[model samples]
Target chain A: MKNQWIHIFSGTVKVKLTGKGIERFLNQLTKNGVSIWNVRKHGSEAVTFYVNLQDVKKLRIPARDSNCKIRFLERAGGPFFLSKLWTNSGFFIGACLFLGLIMLLSNMVWGIEIRGANPATEHHIRKELDKMGISVGKMQFSIDNVESVQRELTDKIGALTWIGVELKGTTYHFQVVEKSEPKKAEVIGPRHLIAKRKAAIVKIFVEKGEPVVKVNDYVLPGQLLVSGLYGNEDDMKTVAASGEILGETWYSTKVELPLKSTFQVFNGSEKRKYSLKIAGRTLPVWGFGDPDFKEYETEVNDHPIKFFKWELPLMVEKKTLREREEVTRIYSREEAVESAKELARKDIKNHLPENAIIKGEKILHQSIENDKVKLTTHFTIIEDIAVGQPISQGD
Target chain B: MAKKWGQYVRKWMTQKMDLPQDVMMDLPRITMIGQVHIYIENHRGLLAFSDGEVRLMIKHGQLLVKGKAFVIKTILPEEILLEGKIDQVIYIND
Candidate 1:
């Protein structure tokens, strides 16, 4: 196999060895490790075979020793092709020039596209980018300097939020996202932390300002938990009143669940169908007749083999649907109570904030009726009750 | 006495080691594939070449193959590959 590849690359010659001493001549050739293949005899005077072009020089010794005459019949492979290439020098030079021209053209930026920008922002960015050597007609490879230029563009143009630099086949695509006006912050001079909910204080740790209330204090919604003012007249100071105040908050939740429920069960059977959709027109390619099951769920999948960037009208869509039977189950009283408790917990969780800790829970009511149960639970949660109130300097 | 020792050693190698007889005794081992191609291993040299026959020198004899369109596909110091329409293969012991 290796010998064949060598013959193919460097070219091989089919030569006819004539005269009576051909066998001795072949023996000498093989002894010297000269590779030859595909030998065939045409009458007693001549035998034809293939030899490597490199080994043709070594054939002279054996030909003379064995009194045989060697003659070339055919030349093949890359060496032969190269020899032909040298004969047409003008065509070769022209071909190289044409290829070099194409390569030269491919490196120059042909078009510049600025997207997601207004005319004013576009003009601003284009000017900045052009000054950074990213304009049209610039060499595409010089865009390596685009990173620092990208930062410069963002800094020079305050309106740009996000900027991108891309070179796509001799075209510069500059994408930009403009910045929107920021909302103004409302700052007040003094502030106090007040109870947002009516609850008994569980814990309070003030990091700044003076504490006005302690733990276990029953406070109304508008009462202050921490005062922002400090010191005694003339040297008095006011901070933002930063503190975490956890209070015991209460909530009530109700839940109802039916004793009987229906669930789906597979019947161990399935059907498949294949179809093709072209330009909004669907042609059923396979599978026939209506579905066997009355209640079944269908899943559709369409895969279109794309060409270039366009979605050709032709596409293959496969739909697989499974049939299921509904079965009803009745729950016992104990089972119903367990499920009812679970339902009541989930319902209370929905009404509580994420940071609200449920410290205690009690079932306030439970009633059973026709195929249903209703339950109500009261929950005690330790949650932050601080609310900021902006006050005037005089207050 | 030396010839006897050589024969004894060849026998021991052939029986004990199970090596190819051609390797142990320096004898030509000819293998043929459906009379289309022939491989002669452990050969001395090629004697004659013709359109209808090939003659090769083996260790103790000359191997003569009479065939039509005879060709020496490959010839080596110790082996030769022949391809032809072979009708007969005769070992003329010398």
Candidate 2:
């Protein structure tokens, strides 16, 4: 039974023998060591039996000696199949070419996504990517890796502050951060320094103006902190007021913090499985067994094979199993309240000027409700609050 | 006279040593599966074969198998596999 395939693969022939003494011819064949089976007598002078295709040539001798005519009834097995394939060689070649084309297309870059860039910069980036051989329809292997791409892009585009490049399957994703243009210096004329916001003066230094208000004085918006006039009123001459005034400003912010939070974190034990997907059926090529971990996360990435612009039904799927554990953090009421105040201070600091100094923070209210801590905090920031106002002719 | 003496001595040796007659005496060994198939080992040659009967030359005689719808399942130099509905097996002394 095990050798059945071997028997068929070597080929077989059904032969019909016609002679006066067919049995003698069969016996002669057997004596010649030509293993024959399924011998059936046809009429009184004819017989039919199956023999190995290779031994057909040997039958000519006994066939001549016995004076019998041997006609091949049927030819089968591997050789016949190969000859049939040869008859349709064109179709076979076409199928092979189609498969090869599909394999080539599946490994090409189909799309390039440029994010966080304006139209002009995006066009520029696309040109650069083309120069690097990373454009659409190009083979992925010919292009550089993502890290090198990022480095090259950052180096080539002077206006870009930072750029991130990622190759996701057949698509390339680019994240670009462009450098902001610096502000030009403005020409100053005769002007007074006025408070842009209501604040209590903390410190004042006048470089080219008369100090009209002293430190610890409270001023409103549009009020003059330093006048452009110099000396007494009789000898007053107007000039640009150049000064730095540190004023104290206050901001109230509300923040909420949850006392309990639950999140999942990976423990770093990972197992990868690779499989070929043909028309929705998956055939695992590696990593046959499923992961034994009970609590885990599965990330499946499917790369669909393509032929030219059309996507083929075949795909390659990669599954990553990572062991994960759920972590629940519980914070005490005091800790929650403290974090809430800290959050509120950070919130106010973000809206303040770059050189602003946080003087103090006072919690106006604190309450715990529904497993959450809510806090209202007031922050005092000391920053430069003076803005130059041009002196009009009427003034 | 010489052949008879050799055969007698071979028969006596087979009985004394408890040896298989087919091995010691050049006799044909026939194995039958029910009435449908038969295997003949150590046969000299096939003399005649038909749908109703099969004849083979044995060491001392010709073995005949009378049956219906007889088909030779396999044929080798030293063995034959015959398939049919068998009625009788007879040996003709020459």
Candidate 3:
């Protein structure tokens, strides 16, 4: 290590001396305290030696006194290499020009892409964007106001609901969401309100139609509850019906619940497995053996390694397997009855409309057989049962 | 007779002064590392260097080194380090 530094700092040079007096010349240099090494002799006349740059100039008198001809072979060191590089300027200029060209080319927008849009919609947006001076081959820094261009596109075309502009590498990526217009409502000319369900009438209110059925009347389905036309038959006027008729209704639901139930309960024993996920591919590093469990559920938790503002493609995933066991428990008669009624209530609740309110609830009948309970529950509901029925063309 | 007596007195002086044998006798202490490196202490000057041979002047004789592609690593006043494939080394009594 020390020898290399000595050679470099001293800046050694190779010299070749030829003639009958080369030995005397070397011996004289040696005696003069000039260190030279690695001497190779050729035919007792020519000799080559490496000496420091400082000592090469001091060899003049010795070479002259010994009558030996001297010639320099090579000069080596950092300074010599730098001097040679400085003499040739064409390579450095070409390299700098190449780098500048690459920088300029990479900063210009080359391709424009529209994502998440249909072709026709994409064409429309592209046209709108082009009119706003956002297009390919433009310099990236020219678009100083991206939101203004987006607003211009929105004002020119009604098809874009939301839009985002992003510049990635040399491509200009545009994200777009198309607009959807609300549908128009249809109007049926004139109609009458009739009984939609078989129930005893609780109350009736005429908002914009004449009442055809009175309160407390048990009406069958399809019967007219309100008339769309008013006045006499000779001077009859047609009108749209609008009214509300509340009916006291009854609903029955049948349920069967078993006295013994089997359930899967987690046993609190868990095993964890680790894996390294790279680009959506998982490679297991340890724990290759299978988990000791009969029935289990796997829950995966992952922690992704992120750098700065970007989430890297690598992650560590831990999978935990929770062991489970099937546990059966016998239910009492009263518990079975309670469960059956709850089941019936839930079933009836699903069938009722939004406006129907449960005024009364009770279990009417319940019977147990073969380790099971069968029950029927009744619910009293009050709701607006008036439905629209259009009049015939004869009217 | 005087020269033989001088040699005896020099040996007795070396032992009395507790000096190293190579330094007292001015002999070349040659060391080698495998066949790739060789170091010679107490060398005087270079005699010849070729592709397959190297010769140097020691105190008592000329040291000949047979090798392939020999190159001198470094040289100081007291020691010279040589590197390459060294096959054999011999001392010429001349």
Among these predicted structures, which one has the highest DockQ?
2
- Per model, kept true contacts as a fraction are 0.65, 0.90, 0.27
lDDT of candidate 1 over A1-395, digit per residue (tens): 23467669878999998888777777788788888877777776788889989999999877777878899999988889788878987898998998666655666678888998989999988888777777777755345445656788888899988889665566677898888735577564578899998888999988877889989998889999889889999887888887799999888888787899898987767677878899888899988677888888886766553333334576667776788889998999889888988887787778767888989989899888988888888888889998887656875
Docking class of 2: acceptable
Per residue, candidate 3 scores C-alpha lDDT tens digits across A1-395 of 24555676558789988887564566567668777887665665777888888888898988877778999999987667677788777899888988667655665668888887888888888887676667788755445345666677677778888878765666777888777635577675678999888888889998877899888999889989999889998987777788789988888888988899899999899888888999999999756778898789997766554433345687667787899999997889998888887888788879988778888888888899999899988888888889988877595
State the lDDT of candidate 1 residue by residue for B1-94, as single tens digits: 9998998989898999998877788877888999898888887877877778778888788999998877776666787788889999999998
**What is the lDDT for A130 in model 1?**
78
Give the runs in model 2 whose Cα sits over 4 Å from its true position.
A1-10, A77-92, A177-395, B66-70, B84-94
Ranking by DockQ: 2, 1, 3
User: Any runs in candidate 1 off by more than 4 Å, and if so which?
Assistant: A1-190, A233-235, A263-270, B1-94
For model 3, fnat equals: 0.27
- Residue A54 of model 1 has an lDDT of 93
Second chain TM-score per prediction?
0.89, 0.92, 0.84
Instruction: Write model 2 residue lDDT over B5-41, tens digit each, in one string.
Output: 9999999999999999999999999999999989999
RMSD of 1: 25.9
The CAPRI quality class of candidate 1 comes to acceptable
Error of 3 at B1 (Å): 10
Candidate 3 stretches greater than 4 Å from native: A5-10, A87-89, A113-135, A142-160, A164-168, A175-395, B1-9, B32-38, B47-73, B82-94
Q: Between candidates 2 and 3, which one is better according to lDDT?
A: 2
The estimated TM-scores of all candidates read 0.41, 0.55, 0.47
**Model 2, A283-353: lDDT tens per residue?**
99998787878788897877666665567798778788999989999999988887777788778878987
Candidate 3 lDDT, B1-94, residue by residue in tens:
9977987888998899988878777889999999999998888876766567877888888999999877666666666788889999999997
